[model samples]
Target: MHPKRKLTTVIAVGVAPLIAVSLPADTADAHGWVTSPASRQDQCFAGTVACGPIKWEPDAVEGPKGLKNCSGGNAQFADLDDDRKGWQVHDVNASETFTWQLTAQHSTSTWQYFVGNQKVAEFDQGGAQPPQFVKHRVNFGSVRGRQKVLAVWNIADTDNAFYACIDVNVRG
Candidate 1:
């Protein structure tokens, strides 16, 4: 074979596998988000609030399992962590049902709800895969007025969890 042709063939053989390996077999799908009560990212996705990238991918606010912020420690979704961002607060009774719409369901370990550092409610799934829609009726006993609720979905098989922040005016 000609010298240049031999070199070109060798390069092609070496590079093809690398390119193929780099390409994923399936595209990354969105996970889940709190729909009812309208979490910050949910508001962004609904166009109720103008936002950054979270407007396009509300279901992707995923991070280390124990994060407290609405953005799940993701800088791309840093807007979610902004308290002054004019997120609409929904009116709710002391006991309310928070609904999650899952685009891609995962095996869930637990669902946790927090107000400040105080854990308001938790549901254990025991590593079971959840349905497309999940709802948790959380009772905010003695906690009233405007509050930011942090909801987390811990994935059973992963080190990450999906985070959402819901602003609510809890009426007694």
Candidate 2:
């Protein structure tokens, strides 16, 4: 083949594959969820913590469901109480609050559960108690020594919204 034709052919061979690879990757909470044993004090998730089975109710006007720093829900942890993490003093009287939220995207269905750094109290969503927030509250148990908490979120649906939120306070 002619030099120009050969060069073009080689370039096309190399560049075509490169272009195809450059396509954006479909990421579905690829990082994985974060977890902290009851004995551990620190819990961190590099990304947002998505709650369980995402609830999707078609918007009256067709729009994404956005939830944020919600309040009221209960709390949850890998373990309710851990006797490990030997500490100078055990904290059993400490209490705090956390708020979580998320925004539901169109054509994205998935329940959100967050696991981020710094564990917070669990906040339940929807209640007979007024001042409703579309989020959950997590109550972190007690801590003896010193510890940090982190967590991340997860999804149950591939067609619902993917989002989560958490906030906590320590009073040990």
Candidate 3:
């Protein structure tokens, strides 16, 4: 064989496996956000709310710890932190079952919901793997009228959490 051809063949043989091995057969999907009551990101995804990059991946608004804000510490989805935006309001009674859609299921530590400074409900997953969907029944107590509810999903292994803000009109 010609010297150049031989070198080419050797290089191809050496590089082929690396290329194939680098290709992933599947990626572990592990992200989720509240959809019920129409979270801010969910509304953006539905075109009901005009937002930034979060409109594309509504469930992936993750950020570092101590993110009590609606953006989950991400500035790209900061529109969620704005109460002035015309977010769609879902009317509900004192209690409602909130649903979270998970594209990739991950072990969760806890799921919490807040209204202003008050935490109305929480679900402790305790590092257990969650299903495709997670549900929590939230109570508004005596609070009524329109309010922005914040939802936080704390991942068990990560230092980050996913955040969602849902606008709701509570009726007694």
Q: Pick the candidate with the highest TM-score.
A: 1
Maximum-lDDT candidate:
1
Give the per-residue Cα lDDT of candidate 1 at 36: 98
The TM-score, computed over Cα atoms with residue i paired to residue i, of candidate 3 is 0.84
Ranking, TM-score, top scorer first: 1, 3, 2
- Give the per-residue lDDT digits (tens) of candidate 3, residues 36-91: 97888999999997888888888888888556788887777788888888988999
Model 2: per-residue lDDT, tens digit, 1-172?
9999999999999899889999998753321211212112212121122222221110111112332222112133222122232312223224432222222222222223332333344323222221211333344544433443332232223222222222222455
lDDT of 2 at 142: 44
TM-score of each: 0.89, 0.25, 0.84
lDDT, model 3, position 31: 83
Please list the residue runs of candidate 3 whose C-alpha ends up more than 4 Å from where it truly belongs after superposition: 1-30
Q: Which is better, 1 or 2, measured by TM-score?
A: 1
Worst 10 residues of 3 by lDDT: 24-33
* Model 2, runs deviating above 4 Å: 1-93, 105-134, 144-146, 158-169
The CA lDDT of each predicted structure is 0.96, 0.30, 0.87
Q: What is the lDDT of candidate 3?
A: 0.87
Q: What is candidate 1's lDDT per residue for 1-172, written digit by digit as tens? A: 9999999999999999999999979968899999998999999999998899999899999999999999999999999999998999999999999999999999999999999999999999999999999999999999999999999999999999999999999999
Report the CA-based lDDT of candidate 2 relative to the real structure: 0.30
